[model samples]
Target: MSRRSRPVVSNRVRRFFASFIFDKPAAAPASVIARHRLLNAGAYDEGSGTINGVMLIAVAAILISAVALGGNFLVCVSDARSAADQAAIAGAESARDGDFDPCIKSRLATTLNKAALVICKVDEEDVTVKVAVKTAVPFAPLVSRMARAGPVECS
Candidate 1:
């Protein structure tokens, strides 16, 4: 006796044809069923809500901390620039007035602005100043800025 070979049809194809014939589909794989159950394990549990709330609060706190640090950095940069400009103007004015040392006034101005004067140069009526602002934030670098002031002659 000889047996005839029959073509094999995939589960997806069988399911599609079964649906058209109003027949039941095949059962899903064990792994898929297990994953679905695991995903919904804590769906109706009261502890899940608390866990989710705690995660949200942690995320919000981190974001707020980052924004505060960023704002502080910007303030530090602005302070450095302002200090440099004030020091340069002070030095230039002192130079024009024939003060014994223009850099002395520049250093005083920076100190008053809560910054340190890194460099101060006076040439005739022109003055250049560099100031640094140090922040209390850990790991933050010192902010520095430079400015120049002089008498401008226009014809």
Candidate 2:
């Protein structure tokens, strides 16, 4: 073939291969490419603003739950202590009357409003009393199934 024709044929073959083998491989959809680039660049970091926000929210939730639990515990403890005091007083009174059952029953009845169980025991010179109180809090049906504060003594 003449030199000029040779150049023409070579150019034609090159163009054919370019079209078939290397034409811009379909540009990945823009969104797909963007996601890949973001991942490759490590755009998400543990110390980033989004992570900090999430940590703050978790801490706040934990603190609120703790406060609620503490409040319920305090209520139960206070009620139990009050019942114990009342029981001791009634037991002492009953000892004077030489009757134990009636005094214990009366004390328990008085503390019903506070949702507590009261027990009284008389021992010669000292009256011993025990109280178990139950309190209801959100989510928890009953806090401290039985909260025992002390055996208040009365002489």
Candidate 3:
């Protein structure tokens, strides 16, 4: 019996030639090629240093704003409490004279000078005094209004 023999090409040899010498289309997909090119492109490259710098600046700005807001709130509350105390004292002193308008005006003036809005009134029949304090926080072109401890003394 006679046997026929076929020509053999090693897989590695074929692959090497096919990759380097063949005129066939690239095996890599278009999307993959585009992605590789984009990754290596200098214009699209963003170094870690630039990104970190921007993040640091953003964090600093946020921290500073938080501190400023807290400080402003503290000042507003302190001024409001002082004004309320003054109003109470004046109201008590004026109660004997049956004239509360002077005391109310004095309290309002004190708060207004300290960037606080105040409304003070005394009920003659009930002998109760009420004080309202409003303060504005500074934010450019935006009104940040807050009211603090309204009607400090109802009775």
Clashes of each: 0, 0, 0
**Candidate that beats the other on lDDT, 1 or 3, i.e. the better one:** 1
Tens-digit lDDT string for candidate 2 (1-155) = 77776544565455656666877444445776798888889885546987889999999999998888889878876766666666666656666566746456435644663644544555663566556666556554442222222235679
Q: Write the per-residue lDDT of candidate 1 for residues 1-155, one digit (tens) a residue.
A: 33556676898667767876886655766776787887698544658788999999999999998888888889999999999999999999999899999999999999999999998888899999999998756678788999999889999
Rank order by TM-score, top first? 1, 2, 3
How much lDDT does candidate 1 score? Answer: 0.88
Predicted candidate 1, C-alpha RMSD: 9.4
User: Per-residue alpha-carbon lDDT of model 3 for 1-155, expressed as tens digits?
Assistant: 33456667787557656876777544665775798898888646667779999999999999998888777767766665565555555554565466636456445545553533334455552223334444445643122232222224567
Best by lDDT: 1
In TM-score terms, candidate 2 sits at: 0.49
Candidate 1 segments exceeding 4 Å error = 1-44
Shift in Å, residue 124, candidate 3: 5.2
How accurate locally is residue 42 in candidate 3, as Cα lDDT from 0 to 100? 60
